[model samples]
Target: MKRRTLLRATGGAVLGGSVGLAGCLDQFSDSESGDTDSHDFPADYETETFDGQTVPFAPLEDVAEWWENDEARFVDARTQVQYDEAHIEGAVFSPSPDGLESADPVAEWDTDTRIVTYCVCPIAQAGQRAATLLDNGYTDVYGLADGFNPWRENGYPVESNDGQASLSTYEIEGETDPADAGEYALAVHPETGQREASRIDADGGYELSLHFVDVPDSSLLELRTPSYELEGTIEEFSSATVQV
Candidate 1:
């Protein structure tokens, strides 16, 4: 499915308060702080308390180190659209606005899981998400100090739906052909019981191109038609470039 269509179908779900892009970018403006060239940590950046616990800010440099060592789980706190466009490799999507009100993707993670939440809005949105995670018993939650833009500017690794790691095509074949299978859904399950659906073209020959990030290696991909269902492992499909 195209990234845009998927985002639209999801109602542009944002994890935090629905701040406009201009407002988010304003965090970097010279008028806001009189220093435009420096990515220095803001002195006024204060600690926020949630459930009587303070959420600490994780420096971009430290987070980058953790990312390289694969020691911390990165959570994107922006809207799904922003996440789809670009995010740190392996970061999970957990929008703040919805995260506080409902069970998010990370809800089932171990309480000791190391997590860092980030957004272009920098503080308000990301901080709220970190606080929420902390309140939920995630002990090592931290907000990315200074947010995504600075990290991107520093040439750190980023992944996007448009990138090579995210683009893959597969052919679906089964007793019930998708062209005639009305209103079917195609989903990828990265973990057991967790399914993220992809957009399907009913008119096409059941050929689906998906972002690889949505279907990590070893994940399960399932196609559900009205009368039949077909499932395959991502490795199996990648092996042959087609599945039956």
Candidate 2:
């Protein structure tokens, strides 16, 4: 969605009054002066609409500029493991739906503050996180258009704990009871502190995506849903089908 909603002010002069609206004009001038210090995003950015929520998607190029200037708060929407492995430097690790928890730095930001969110899935998780911010009354929020993959691939600034470790994405999907629709599905690795969450679709299906960095085959993973939980090794979980 390459569109912008510009605010317009309409006014007319009253000829009969000799005294001008000086106080109101002064107040408006002060507000305008204050706004000049705040950062503004360009109008040509894209947007994504998911699950009835819409959020603007700013290209990595633009985001990089903001990052360099420290003009926006960067939020990593990936799991703790993914974030720990690699993330845009200085990014806050705040996963979606739970992003605004008191523990996250974003929780302390003002509603008018500029925020950018990103995930390895490119726009999927980032879009969700940005939408969540919009729902929470964040006026200026954007999703990193191509996400962390491109940023990392293009050699942008990033903080990595295990740069030599190979990163892999695994998608585990299965059906759930109809009653469990709208609930959350989570994949958790207790030892590594890796966790991923996805909302169960209305059709009783869900795909929980996990990003791992050199995860051991013997590592235990807990696949959990509102109705049931299954524990198995990482290899087992990669091929297992969750049914509840």
Best by TM-score: 2
What is the Å distance of residue 89 in model 1 from its true position? 0.4
TM-score against native, each model: 0.47, 0.63
| Model 2 lDDT at residue 168 | 70
lDDT (0-100) at residue 147 of candidate 2? Answer: 67
lDDT of 2 at 121: 45
Query: Mind giving the per-residue lDDT tens digits that candidate 2 earns over 31-86?
Result: 11112112345667654454445566777788999989989989988766677789
Which residue runs of candidate 2 sit more than 4 Å off their true CA positions? 1-54, 68-70, 99-103, 107-110, 122-132, 135-137, 161-166, 178-182
- lDDT values of the candidates? 0.52, 0.64
lDDT of 1 by residue, 20-133 (tens): 111332222221122121122345543443223355666778899999998899888765655776899899888763362466778878988888888752344575577667
Q: In model 1, which regions exceed 4 Å deviation? A: 1-46, 49-53, 98-103, 163-244
